[model samples]
Target: VSCIARHISLTVGCCWLDGENQPHMKAVFPTEKAVHDHFENLLRILSYEPLYAQIRIKRSNDETVLVGSSLIYFLFIVQMRNMDWLSDLNTTLKNTMVSIIDASINDEVAMCCYGVLCEILTDEESKDLSISDNICNYFLQMLEDIWNKTKKKYEHVPIMMLLKGFQTLSKNDSMQQETAVSNRIHIFIEICDEYPIAYDVIWALSFNKDIQQQLRSDSPFICKLTQLSRQPENEQMSKIIDGILWNLEINHENRSMTDKHNTKEFDIMISYSHKEKVLCKQIYEELIKAGYRVWIDFDQMHGNVMDAMAQAIEQSNTVIMCMSEQYRKSNYCRAEAQYAFQRERKIVPILLQKQYKPDGWLLFIIGQLLYVDFNKYEFSRAMQMLHNELKVELMAETHTAPVRPKEDSVVAHSTTYISPPEVLRSSIVSENILDWTQSQVQDWLLGHNLRQLSRLFAACDGRSLLYLSKYMKNCEPQQILDLLEADSVRRLNESISLIELSSFHSVMHEKKKRLPSMYSSNT
Candidate 1:
């Protein structure tokens, strides 16, 4: 019986591969009975200590090892397709797969191991499998090793696999809380600079507010994003980078507003069924953290429910319907949608559940409109899509008046126009200050007084400050109290006149013109 089972397993493994390096294809089982029998035999063999021991010894031989590894890889591929199979896998089978991942010399075998591990960790149905912090760390280390080996070969398959694994792992809140996972995410962002395939992984990591905060604090990562944004060929990458930057900027602005007095209207109103409040609240928190002023019933405890809901939908610039089966059934949610529609507000439909489809009245209202799929990508990627949409709407609504500043005010003079020091100070103090590109800073500082420009240049380091000075020819200034360190920022408390600086420059230019002629005549 043992000999026959081993032969059948090898045959099944070979058929599973289907002569392809990739293991995504279906196994060529001879019959329905054969498929059931093959898995039944696999479970029995993997559970039996004596049989598994014999298989391990056989795996030592070169020819037997290849077949044995293929068999294990095949099992993983099967498990990925049918997560129910994982319920039958005992500790012995799980450990065997982990061992194969740890000990495998072949990249393809390792990739398969990681793929299965990801499936077990991420799939909702496979939650029985134990995935400890140490195990997660081991998987991340293995992924890094594979990334270093395969990144140069233009083999994005392994990196993509690893990213999928990371994305799956991130879905678990416990795994996300692990310090090791957080460090891995940071390292992965660095890897993204070399491998564009890892960008999606970065996007997944960004969904976690903690990870986003970490990225915001990381100067090098922000610099990498800024550099990538300048590459016209990297349009998709640029879009992701822009979304992250926009989120960071908006959050900063929102925090600043919150700290001070913010009288601005809500950017969005969230409507959903009370039954789906958990998901709605999660979306609400994410939106608020991303910097949008969101109005939801959770924050409106003091108001009349119907009246407040109507007022919120009417006042908000956009209404986001958290579309789900429950939402469709809710009368209140429908009323909010109708009011937003009647008010001619921009209504963004977001599909909250994987199985949710708009139907009947809800379908009539939102069916014609394009919606962002929260279930399609990882949460952060979907949030980014929604954010990009909101950003576009916000940009469209931003209309600057043609009114000019008074002549005596700083804005009247091209060279002496100083922005409120408080505004510049706030930007300089922001965690995302480094995210500002050179061109953006230049644009902001344009037409400022020479001394203020000098002070600004002094705040930056050597080369950048020198480069900025070129734009300061018609600039303004406030005296620098102290020279700032390369990485430090200090607010200028006092303002000074640009008249002295401008006169000094004029005198210097006059002297320079006469000096050349004077030297020539003397010679």
Candidate 2:
């Protein structure tokens, strides 16, 4: 009906169509609200028309006014049409947009504009969509300027915009200018530390094949930035890292899929108290029989139980905590359990003792997790249930969700780097801060999964990020990358920036002068 009215209006030209009176013209809408309604109706009809499609900004009084975000509303449809259409929108217009983004006073409006722009740029409606270098640079410069000037005010929003802008830039194969990308990334990481939005930017940047490759072959900036970003929300850092590993595994699986090779089996460490060792052993043996390798730490540590624990947990598929009478009573078990819990591992607790419940204060510590029970001698049934559950959970966490390319499966949302929502918004508070060892950070990251990492990062101090960075310098690049993941790297990226802002960057560099650079001549 709206389309028919619009078509009749166009045919009649400068005339309003009437509902009755036999194809007669009616008076124009007198009120603003009525005019808005008529215009919105017209826009709805215009959206379907081939030529007028993708027109979110309209010109009527010789001014480019935002229409309905209707273009972005139908973003998928527009994206399906042709991304080349975006390139045709005139570079001058994009430049004007850059100016508008810079000059805008209303943060809300600026955010809306930013959203619209990002929606268009990252639109996945078209397979071969391309964004131009000049436009990307314009947004990048705008973001950089905002970061440098508004560090004290609106500290976080800029980095998110910068990240989204960079995402579009990163997608441009033509824009693979290594130096430019690296410098932008460096500045981005720097700003992320001071501001709360670093995670989004770093997360987006890590998706770029070139950026990922460049990061691997690190220079000093990359090494420092990588360490810094992995510092915060150690738990999130772990998830982001796990997400990366999952991606790598998916890639590996794709390469090996055709050969019908057996899926690789992995060992998981079971850390329990001596009293629960029998139950733990039962679970461990069950896992081994089900085709999973298992590791159990029964006795006391020889040298560094921390490192040994870290190594064991890092190699495992999951960490099984036998939450029983002995585990609840032993501080050693609880401490080790907490450490493994922080590493983003798939933790399964076999509830053994009905009398042993987490305490009142530990309620805050334990959250609302429901543990599997195996307190009785129903060992066989419990073992079978554990095997099935472990198999499913392990596969889901480790494997990428299969994709149907022809159907345009939602762009593989698993990021190469992931971060928690909190890290992108706030700073580390005093109460949450804890002085932790490097080995501790590694164990925390390698042992837990994403959900747990968010809580751990939230509970950490700013110093912990730098501490982790320094500690990680001793580990191999692959090991570090495996532990940090892209999301964690992003957090570390921001942490580095915060340190620099506090003049702690210089302090850390001075403090760690003896540490060998990952990007040094060794590469």
Candidate 3:
């Protein structure tokens, strides 16, 4: 009787009564032919249903019996792992197993049931079982709850096994499975945050084009992953997150570039010598007000100066050269022009000085390109010409101007330039100038060039220049030109004419006499 009970507990706990349970009993009791013959009629009369019902009745009668019955169900699941019983599980039996899992608090029993469910869900033979979405959601919810509660307390082996099972289920190419995985991206990110092991799951999901599109659209989630990737403690996690972000950013940029109306980071990087800064500054301010993203050195001061310049040139769509005698003389300015030319970045040269003509490397770089001539026109007129030229250049680059409908008398120009909307105007013109305290600004003016100082003083009060100079001290001499330009625009109530090179020293001498009290205070 004990032998019969043990065999019955193992065979009948998970299987239904009518179909395969009787055949399984015959296999378990094969050596005891007489015993099997003796019990065949009784077993046929009382199949798995009556036996399982009796176990439940006993379990309800005693707490210890309930635990024992759970262990019996757990053991039956473990034994069936080697067998192909997944497809044979009917809806009622599967529900009973899930119910046992829900009611039990024992880790062993719960884990065993979880393993059984994972096996069945992932098994190829059970693909046609028609598992409901509600059941899958409930199963995942229970697993997540358990993981949240015990993940820190226990080893990750059991949780990893469950996650591996989930990854396996997602590996299938069916639309339903793909949809299921895509809907849980937030959950997957949570898993990634909590368990580094789940990064493989994220890596796998990224290969699916649809999943990549979904992640790209969800910027906040991607940003969270980016913040995690920047942490210094975990190199492996950082690399994986970086790869995911790279894939997402590359795909997003490719799509955006195809639509030519999209605005990029910077339209141009203004490269010039500090000697020609006064005019360069004016040009910079005008470009900003006109809605072009101009990368001069002022706003990009976070890293090594040369690297920053190179990166800016690479990121910009074109390089705007404020060409002059000083631009050709300075090694740093020459380097910027050569680097831009080598990178195949469009070079738009604006002649800043009247007598200066391009030669040597400058001539080699911009000699062939048509340039905007500031020398020939009045300041405002020259600016309008430059603006118009920029419009033409941008139209040529984008190749996306809208066409007018055909008319009998009108000719359609496919390359017509359109003015950018006012809303596209850069906030750099309106954003607060770099934060600099008054004392820090005073320290920078102690030994600076008189002409640069005169220009700074003209644009702002001595105190404001001193304050603004604190932020400008680390900037390259060329970038300081841009900062001075932006400062002059932000603080000056009226437009100042560009200082003439020949008269710059004489003007500085006059300005020096007017600011004697300022010099005295500094002394």
Candidate 4:
């Protein structure tokens, strides 16, 4: 049994790939094929005659049941569209699960069974025409049965999945006052602190004004959320707390939507599927630390989602596109990506999964943008490249942009104005800052009394130089000199001086007075 369990895990858990053919740290999402291949074991297990079973797995070990059920969960929630036999599979699994639950009360396998069904019913992708309203009601009936069976028990497992399922139902106005929902909500509030799954509770009750007020007034629960928020290591839970605060209007130190991040104009908006939350959160944090105002959904899909998303994207100067198979397939992500494209938001695509190419609509949406593959580059190197790209002020490009591309094939949005390193090395650059030559750039800077910025401008162009101008429009000459000297030294990775602003230019005599380089010893 253990050997079979191990084999099942190994079959489904082939996440990382090797060098060309060797080994590396790249984590690739398991393909639908691999999942279906492993799913055969589940069929074998379910098609059981305890004595005649060729696999010789023991009935006593519930671990096998758990593993098989987990795989089923993934199939239903993550890869349902790929399963042609899903309807039949669902029936077989439902019957088998009923047998398991009848065999024992409050069993872990039974709990998982409920959780899987609830997850599937609530999944955004679970809207196939084959999965009808009757099928949904059948699951709901099972949930009611389980709740009744375990009401006296009142365990987390019973409440855990049932509440999530209820949360989904609560979204419908017709279902709001349903008896089952009311029964669940009553228990959900009374025993809320007993379960750690606050995410489900907060969102399920988001539209309910009375419940929102009720949860807000629950001082102990709010305090518990505070403690969860403070533990930096519990990042997933921390995000959950943030969401809870947002949903219930719980205002604490650093725990409200009224914070600057909500109101401020965003520098970058990240459009991603929830599967990539961890990496996206890391990117968000890094950007925040670097002084860029970033916007991310944070899985907080509260009140008028489309309106909120449009506002965020509108405020952002650029959108970071996290590309993965899930991202490509998700309708929600597709909507966000399409909107960003339509809004003419500058997009930077990053590959969040290995070997997952965008085909249909995603291909159309991103076109030919060069995406940074995490598989090829380490995180640090990738972040450095991202930071460098974002440093050029994105907002400045609005004025410089010409007509939108009529041709749909891989239109180079930002590339038209931003020159390559080799091109920047030459005197002339291109149309916007992206297109202008170095000499033209420096000449403009010299006129602005940002002469010291010429040194920093060696590798800089586009919105970056213009951002510096807008940033320092009100700054004193000494202040500009101080900031520029610091930036140049850090960027060039050498100690430069205050006097260096007026001191040197390799292109000073080479180019005409259009922009004169400051006098330096090298001059």
Q: Which candidate comes out best when scored by lDDT?
A: 1
In terms of TM-score, how similar is model 1 to the real structure?
0.38
For candidate 4, lDDT tens digit of each residue in 163-217? 5444444433223323234434444544445554535445444435555666667
- Please list the C-alpha lDDT of all candidates, in the order they appear: 0.51, 0.42, 0.50, 0.50
* TM-score (C-alpha, index-matched) for candidate 3: 0.28
Q: State how far residue 296 of model 3 sits from its true place (Å).
A: 46
Could you tell me the TM-score of candidate 4? 0.37
Q: Write the number of the candidate with greater TM-score, choosing between 1 and 4.
A: 1
The TM-scores, one per candidate, come to: 0.38, 0.28, 0.28, 0.37
| Candidate 3 whole-model C-alpha lDDT, 0 to 1 | 0.50
Model 4 RMSD, rounded to 1 decimal: 18.1
Model 1 residue 150 distance off true place after TM-score fit, in angstroms: 6.8
Number of colliding residue pairs in each model: 13, 25, 1, 17
| Cα RMSD to the true fold for all candidates | 24.3, 27.6, 27.2, 18.1
The regions of model 1 sitting more than 4 angstroms off are 1-51, 54-59, 62-114, 122-131, 150-160, 179-182, 208-210, 227-239, 246-523
Stretch of 10 with least lDDT, candidate 4: 410-419
The candidate with the higher lDDT, 2 or 3, is: 3
In angstroms, how far off is 498's CA in candidate 2?
Answer: 63
By summed lDDT, which 10 consecutive residues of candidate 3 come out lowest?
408-417
